[model samples]
Target: MTKGLDLHFPHQTGFLSLTAAAVSHQFVNEAKNWTEAQSHCRSHYTDLATLYNTDDVNALTQLGSPTGSAWIGLYDDLIDSWRWSITNSSFYGPGETEFRNWNVPQEPNNAFGQELCAHMQSDGTWNDLPCASAFINFVCYGGNDQYVLINQGRTWNDAQSYCRANYIDLPSIRNATENEKVQVVANGNNVWIGLYRTRTWSDGSDSSFRHWNSSQPDNLNGQQHCTAMSFSDAGQWTDEDCATTLPFFCYIADRPTVVTLRAVVDAADELTEAEIEETILKPLREELIRNGLPNSTSLRLRKVYQTNP
Candidate 1:
């Protein structure tokens, strides 16, 4: 019977324990505008801080414990950000979400930087307007492509609530055909659609989680487009002017690096390196996975200098 081989590894095996990527935060007390702060973060660390969950938010809050507010990574993009209220991607066909029929060059000029909501014109063209604009009618969509025009004037948010409570949501005009259908329902009066825009993270994370104070993100004075965390307010977030100078937080992550292990093993005299890999290394990897190693991790032998050492 062949006896078991006693193996020794010179370096850390990474396989014995899980290696997780750690994220840390750095607070720069120097005041800078949002853009400038973002530049500093990218230059020095990973990027402006992006809080994903309660844990992340709490960690950041505890890390800084700052005396005042600081810039984060979120910002409102006024262009190319229109989206439907019905966000289930499975409901949209190919290219459905990209549909738009703006009046072009003139419409959606974001007159006061507060034109975050979209509306349909009497001629079926689209325009951007402040969400709180009064006396605007809206259209609601039921399943099976059915649309209902509500003549009662309501703000964009109210209209959205009404539609959600009654129908599936505000109409998502996917193409000229759908746009014409909505226009026909309006019967020559302007109406609201589901299309609207919102803020996004600098790191391109699609997380929709937000921590805002009461009556926050008012887009105050139509100029507040950048986000900041107010440590004094229990780490709640608020939108501020992008040009406002404020201390900021940056996110940092450890770079992934290979942890190589020099393994010494005793095996049968006839065993080859490939045989050792198949008999010993393969089972070792399987055991590591069973213990807690991530499945995405890869293992391989770079080279074998000696058969038995």
Candidate 2:
């Protein structure tokens, strides 16, 4: 009887199916060059996609469909350095070791000078190539905050000026969320933000208020005082002095409220609109009326919008 009896079992395939669905949804493919790819990823999909670990990369590989090369949001121009195109920080896990394919000396001989471009090979390893090379198909990721996209394509100084004229201050990173948000927006290109250590906030003199992720403000072997954001390292901040001539980030406070007529026109009318404001409006109005006008003869009654209360 026991041998003939059947037992019910839970279907485990559902979980695998769900995982496959998720992997399929996160993959993206587009055709373009480095700049064009960046633009397409930022505009159509997400600003910058994140590669947290090997699993994420694997998921992306699966989503790539038909098994061909695609451009990822990662690259480095300096040396054998690797960084995320969004934050420009070196925070990717060790899993990337299995995915890297160095050309010969395993680093940048700077052979062609600035020929720094990384591409995903069919074998799933990354390789450096000349940026001028045309390629098709790019992958994108989701999960980034909505930030102001400044496509200045200008040098760092000009970019700073543009940010200042339009916003409150250059971009600032208070926490990881903001960092990721910026990274996602920039995707795979270098951008600027509002953080630097040129002048000390305390005395307006050099006091070294530089904040960095690791041995940063490393100045990379020099005393770099200004800072700029790189898409290579997950938006991690670094200082390189103000004269480095890189893009900058600016942060604008919310729009200010427009002045109202009633707010400007006070009881005394003695204090000019400039003098009386929200805090000082009533007090100055009272004080002016109490003190009275210095030159009564000079005062002329203008047409009143409302009868004097």
Clashes of each: 0, 32
Q: Rate the local accuracy (lDDT) of all candidates.
A: 0.76, 0.34
- Give per-residue CA lDDT, model 2, range 127-146, as digits (tens): 45444443322222222333
TM-scores for all candidates: the values are: 0.60, 0.22
Q: Quick one: best TM-score, which candidate?
A: 1
What is the C-alpha local distance difference test score of candidate 1? Answer: 0.76
Clashes of 2: 32
RMSD of each: 15.8, 29.3
Residue runs of model 1 more than 4 Å from their true location after superposition: 1-23, 30-36, 39-45, 52-69, 111-113, 206-224, 229-246, 253-309
